[model samples]
Target: MSETHNDPLARVMRRYLRRSGIIHLPVVYSTEEPVVFTQPVSDNVLGSFCSVTGTGGLFLAARVIRDLVDPDKDGREKK
Candidate 1:
Protein backbone atom coordinates (compact mmCIF):
# COMPACT_ATOMS: atom_id res chain seq x y z
CA MET A 1 0.00 0.00 0.00
CA SER A 2 1.08 3.55 -0.66
CA GLU A 3 2.27 5.69 2.26
CA THR A 4 -0.62 8.10 1.89
CA HIS A 5 -3.01 5.11 1.95
CA ASN A 6 -1.91 4.49 5.51
CA ASP A 7 -2.77 6.64 8.51
CA PRO A 8 -0.05 9.32 8.51
CA LEU A 9 -1.16 10.94 11.74
CA ALA A 10 -1.29 7.63 13.55
CA ARG A 11 2.13 6.75 12.19
CA VAL A 12 3.55 10.11 13.25
CA MET A 13 1.86 9.87 16.62
CA ARG A 14 3.21 6.37 17.15
CA ARG A 15 6.74 7.41 16.27
CA TYR A 16 6.54 10.51 18.50
CA LEU A 17 5.06 8.64 21.45
CA ARG A 18 7.62 5.88 21.09
CA ARG A 19 10.45 8.38 21.05
CA SER A 20 8.93 10.11 24.09
CA GLY A 21 8.86 6.77 25.99
CA ILE A 22 5.10 6.47 25.96
CA ILE A 23 4.45 3.02 24.57
CA HIS A 24 1.39 1.75 26.39
CA LEU A 25 -1.22 4.42 25.89
CA PRO A 26 -3.02 4.93 22.58
CA VAL A 27 -4.14 8.42 21.61
CA VAL A 28 -7.61 9.08 20.34
CA TYR A 29 -9.17 12.19 18.87
CA SER A 30 -12.86 12.85 19.13
CA THR A 31 -14.10 14.16 15.73
CA GLU A 32 -17.37 15.86 16.43
CA GLU A 33 -17.54 17.86 13.22
CA PRO A 34 -19.19 16.54 10.10
CA VAL A 35 -17.05 15.72 7.05
CA VAL A 36 -18.14 16.04 3.44
CA PHE A 37 -16.58 13.28 1.42
CA THR A 38 -17.38 10.16 -0.61
CA GLN A 39 -14.43 7.90 0.03
CA PRO A 40 -14.36 4.35 1.35
CA VAL A 41 -15.01 4.05 5.08
CA SER A 42 -11.56 2.73 5.97
CA ASP A 43 -9.90 5.43 3.89
CA ASN A 44 -12.05 7.97 5.63
CA VAL A 45 -10.92 7.24 9.16
CA LEU A 46 -8.89 9.53 11.41
CA GLY A 47 -6.23 11.67 9.73
CA SER A 48 -7.00 10.16 6.37
CA PHE A 49 -10.28 11.97 6.35
CA CYS A 50 -8.64 15.21 7.33
CA SER A 51 -6.07 14.92 4.58
CA VAL A 52 -8.62 13.97 2.00
CA THR A 53 -10.98 16.72 3.03
CA GLY A 54 -8.25 19.35 3.48
CA THR A 55 -9.66 20.06 6.89
CA GLY A 56 -8.25 21.04 10.27
CA GLY A 57 -5.11 18.90 10.23
CA LEU A 58 -2.70 21.74 11.04
CA PHE A 59 -5.14 23.32 13.45
CA LEU A 60 -5.59 20.04 15.29
CA ALA A 61 -1.84 19.48 15.55
CA ALA A 62 -1.23 23.02 16.77
CA ARG A 63 -4.05 22.77 19.29
CA VAL A 64 -2.81 19.46 20.67
CA ILE A 65 0.74 20.73 20.94
CA ARG A 66 -0.42 23.98 22.48
CA ASP A 67 -2.43 22.07 25.05
CA LEU A 68 0.61 20.00 25.90
CA VAL A 69 2.87 23.05 26.15
CA ASP A 70 0.60 25.44 28.02
CA PRO A 71 -2.57 23.62 28.89
CA ASP A 72 -3.49 25.60 32.00
CA LYS A 73 -3.70 28.75 29.88
CA ASP A 74 -6.82 29.05 27.77
CA GLY A 75 -5.88 29.52 24.09
CA ARG A 76 -8.66 32.04 23.52
CA GLU A 77 -7.25 34.37 26.15
CA LYS A 78 -4.28 35.11 23.93
CA LYS A 79 -6.45 36.20 21.03
Candidate 2:
Protein backbone atom coordinates (compact mmCIF):
# COMPACT_ATOMS: atom_id res chain seq x y z
CA MET A 1 0.00 0.00 0.00
CA SER A 2 1.15 3.49 -0.79
CA GLU A 3 1.41 6.16 1.89
CA THR A 4 -0.83 9.20 1.59
CA HIS A 5 0.22 12.53 3.03
CA ASN A 6 -2.07 14.73 0.99
CA ASP A 7 -5.30 13.21 2.19
CA PRO A 8 -7.63 15.61 3.97
CA LEU A 9 -8.31 13.18 6.79
CA ALA A 10 -4.62 12.67 7.29
CA ARG A 11 -4.03 16.39 7.52
CA VAL A 12 -6.79 16.73 10.08
CA MET A 13 -5.46 13.88 12.16
CA ARG A 14 -1.95 15.31 12.00
CA ARG A 15 -3.22 18.70 13.10
CA TYR A 16 -5.03 17.20 16.04
CA LEU A 17 -2.05 15.19 17.13
CA ARG A 18 0.21 18.23 16.91
CA ARG A 19 -2.24 20.24 18.97
CA SER A 20 -2.20 17.45 21.51
CA GLY A 21 1.63 17.73 21.75
CA ILE A 22 2.34 14.49 20.02
CA ILE A 23 5.17 15.78 17.87
CA HIS A 24 7.86 13.23 18.45
CA LEU A 25 6.30 10.30 16.69
CA PRO A 26 5.77 10.48 12.95
CA VAL A 27 2.21 10.40 11.68
CA VAL A 28 1.85 7.96 8.83
CA TYR A 29 -1.37 7.63 6.88
CA SER A 30 -2.00 4.95 4.31
CA THR A 31 -4.80 3.17 2.57
CA GLU A 32 -5.17 -0.53 1.93
CA GLU A 33 -7.83 -2.79 0.51
CA PRO A 34 -9.92 -4.32 3.24
CA VAL A 35 -9.10 -7.97 3.76
CA VAL A 36 -12.35 -9.74 4.49
CA PHE A 37 -12.56 -13.37 5.33
CA THR A 38 -15.60 -15.27 4.18
CA GLN A 39 -16.15 -17.13 7.38
CA PRO A 40 -19.06 -17.52 9.78
CA VAL A 41 -18.16 -14.27 11.48
CA SER A 42 -20.49 -11.41 12.31
CA ASP A 43 -19.69 -8.10 10.64
CA ASN A 44 -20.05 -6.19 13.90
CA VAL A 45 -17.49 -8.35 15.66
CA LEU A 46 -14.95 -8.03 12.87
CA GLY A 47 -15.50 -4.30 12.59
CA SER A 48 -15.03 -3.78 16.30
CA PHE A 49 -11.83 -5.79 16.36
CA CYS A 50 -10.35 -3.89 13.41
CA SER A 51 -11.36 -0.54 14.87
CA VAL A 52 -9.80 -1.24 18.22
CA THR A 53 -6.65 -2.81 16.86
CA GLY A 54 -6.14 -0.11 14.23
CA THR A 55 -7.30 3.19 15.73
CA GLY A 56 -6.83 2.28 19.37
CA GLY A 57 -3.29 1.13 18.77
CA LEU A 58 -2.29 4.52 17.36
CA PHE A 59 -3.62 6.42 20.37
CA LEU A 60 -2.04 3.99 22.79
CA ALA A 61 1.32 4.27 21.08
CA ALA A 62 1.11 8.05 20.99
CA ARG A 63 0.31 8.17 24.69
CA VAL A 64 3.29 6.04 25.50
CA ILE A 65 5.60 8.19 23.40
CA ARG A 66 4.25 11.44 24.83
CA ASP A 67 4.72 10.17 28.37
CA LEU A 68 8.24 9.10 27.61
CA VAL A 69 9.04 12.52 26.14
CA ASP A 70 7.87 14.52 29.16
CA PRO A 71 5.54 12.99 31.65
CA ASP A 72 5.09 16.05 33.86
CA LYS A 73 4.07 18.55 31.27
CA ASP A 74 0.50 18.81 30.05
CA GLY A 75 0.29 18.29 26.27
CA ARG A 76 -1.62 21.49 25.54
CA GLU A 77 0.90 24.22 24.94
CA LYS A 78 4.21 23.89 23.21
CA LYS A 79 7.37 24.81 25.08
Candidate 3:
Protein backbone atom coordinates (compact mmCIF):
# COMPACT_ATOMS: atom_id res chain seq x y z
CA MET A 1 0.00 0.00 0.00
CA SER A 2 1.08 3.57 -0.62
CA GLU A 3 0.83 4.46 3.05
CA THR A 4 3.00 1.53 4.04
CA HIS A 5 5.50 2.24 1.29
CA ASN A 6 6.39 5.44 3.10
CA ASP A 7 7.41 3.49 6.21
CA PRO A 8 9.51 0.39 5.88
CA LEU A 9 8.77 -0.68 9.46
CA ALA A 10 5.04 -0.50 8.94
CA ARG A 11 5.33 -2.31 5.65
CA VAL A 12 7.30 -5.13 7.22
CA MET A 13 4.85 -5.49 10.07
CA ARG A 14 1.92 -5.57 7.68
CA ARG A 15 3.53 -8.23 5.54
CA TYR A 16 4.43 -10.29 8.58
CA LEU A 17 0.94 -10.10 9.96
CA ARG A 18 -0.57 -11.11 6.65
CA ARG A 19 1.69 -14.12 6.42
CA SER A 20 0.75 -15.02 9.98
CA GLY A 21 -2.92 -15.07 8.98
CA ILE A 22 -3.83 -12.48 11.53
CA ILE A 23 -6.76 -10.15 10.99
CA HIS A 24 -5.62 -6.57 11.32
CA LEU A 25 -8.78 -4.54 11.07
CA PRO A 26 -10.06 -1.60 12.99
CA VAL A 27 -12.41 -2.63 15.83
CA VAL A 28 -15.82 -0.99 15.87
CA TYR A 29 -17.96 -0.96 19.04
CA SER A 30 -21.73 -0.79 19.19
CA THR A 31 -24.48 -0.80 21.82
CA GLU A 32 -28.07 0.40 22.21
CA GLU A 33 -27.72 1.97 25.65
CA PRO A 34 -25.29 4.85 25.25
CA VAL A 35 -22.14 3.19 23.96
CA VAL A 36 -19.33 5.11 25.66
CA PHE A 37 -16.54 2.60 25.28
CA THR A 38 -14.17 1.72 22.44
CA GLN A 39 -10.94 -0.21 21.90
CA PRO A 40 -8.57 -1.70 19.37
CA VAL A 41 -8.93 -5.48 19.03
CA SER A 42 -6.10 -6.47 16.80
CA ASP A 43 -7.45 -6.44 13.21
CA ASN A 44 -10.73 -8.28 13.71
CA VAL A 45 -14.08 -6.66 14.37
CA LEU A 46 -15.70 -7.03 17.78
CA GLY A 47 -19.45 -6.96 18.40
CA SER A 48 -18.96 -5.31 21.77
CA PHE A 49 -16.39 -2.80 22.89
CA CYS A 50 -13.05 -4.30 23.97
CA SER A 51 -12.32 -1.51 26.36
CA VAL A 52 -8.69 -0.72 27.16
CA THR A 53 -9.44 1.56 30.07
CA GLY A 54 -10.45 0.56 33.58
CA THR A 55 -13.18 3.17 34.06
CA GLY A 56 -15.13 2.50 30.86
CA GLY A 57 -14.76 -1.26 31.10
CA LEU A 58 -15.83 -1.25 34.74
CA PHE A 59 -18.80 0.94 33.94
CA LEU A 60 -19.97 -1.25 31.11
CA ALA A 61 -19.52 -4.37 33.19
CA ALA A 62 -21.41 -2.82 36.05
CA ARG A 63 -24.25 -1.79 33.76
CA VAL A 64 -24.57 -5.27 32.29
CA ILE A 65 -24.47 -6.91 35.71
CA ARG A 66 -27.02 -4.49 37.11
CA ASP A 67 -29.33 -5.02 34.16
CA LEU A 68 -29.00 -8.77 34.45
CA VAL A 69 -29.79 -8.60 38.15
CA ASP A 70 -33.14 -6.98 37.46
CA PRO A 71 -34.05 -8.50 34.06
CA ASP A 72 -37.28 -6.49 34.17
CA LYS A 73 -38.39 -4.31 31.29
CA ASP A 74 -40.71 -2.17 33.45
CA GLY A 75 -37.82 -0.59 35.37
CA ARG A 76 -38.68 -2.58 38.47
CA GLU A 77 -36.02 -3.84 40.83
CA LYS A 78 -36.12 -7.42 41.99
CA LYS A 79 -36.96 -8.01 45.62
Best by lDDT: 2
Residue 66, candidate 2: C-alpha displacement in angstroms: 0.3
Residue-wise lDDT of candidate 3 within 1-79, one digit each (tens)?
A: 2223344555677788788887542211223343344775565655545554556667567656766897564233498
Which regions of candidate 1 are displaced past 4 Å?
1-52, 77-79
- List the candidates' TM-scores in order: 0.30, 0.32, 0.26
Q: Which parts of model 3 are misplaced by more than 4 Å? A: 1-52, 73-79
lDDT of each: 0.56, 0.62, 0.51
- Across 4-74, the per-residue lDDT of candidate 1 in tens digits comes to 22455666777787788875542334434445668667754674554644445665577678879997864
- Per-prediction tally of clashes: 0, 0, 2
lDDT of 1 at 69: 100
Give the higher-lDDT candidate: 1 or 3.
1
Candidate ranking (lDDT, best to worst): 2, 1, 3
lDDT of 3 at 71: 59
lDDT of 1 at 19: 87
Pairs with steric clashes in candidate 2: none
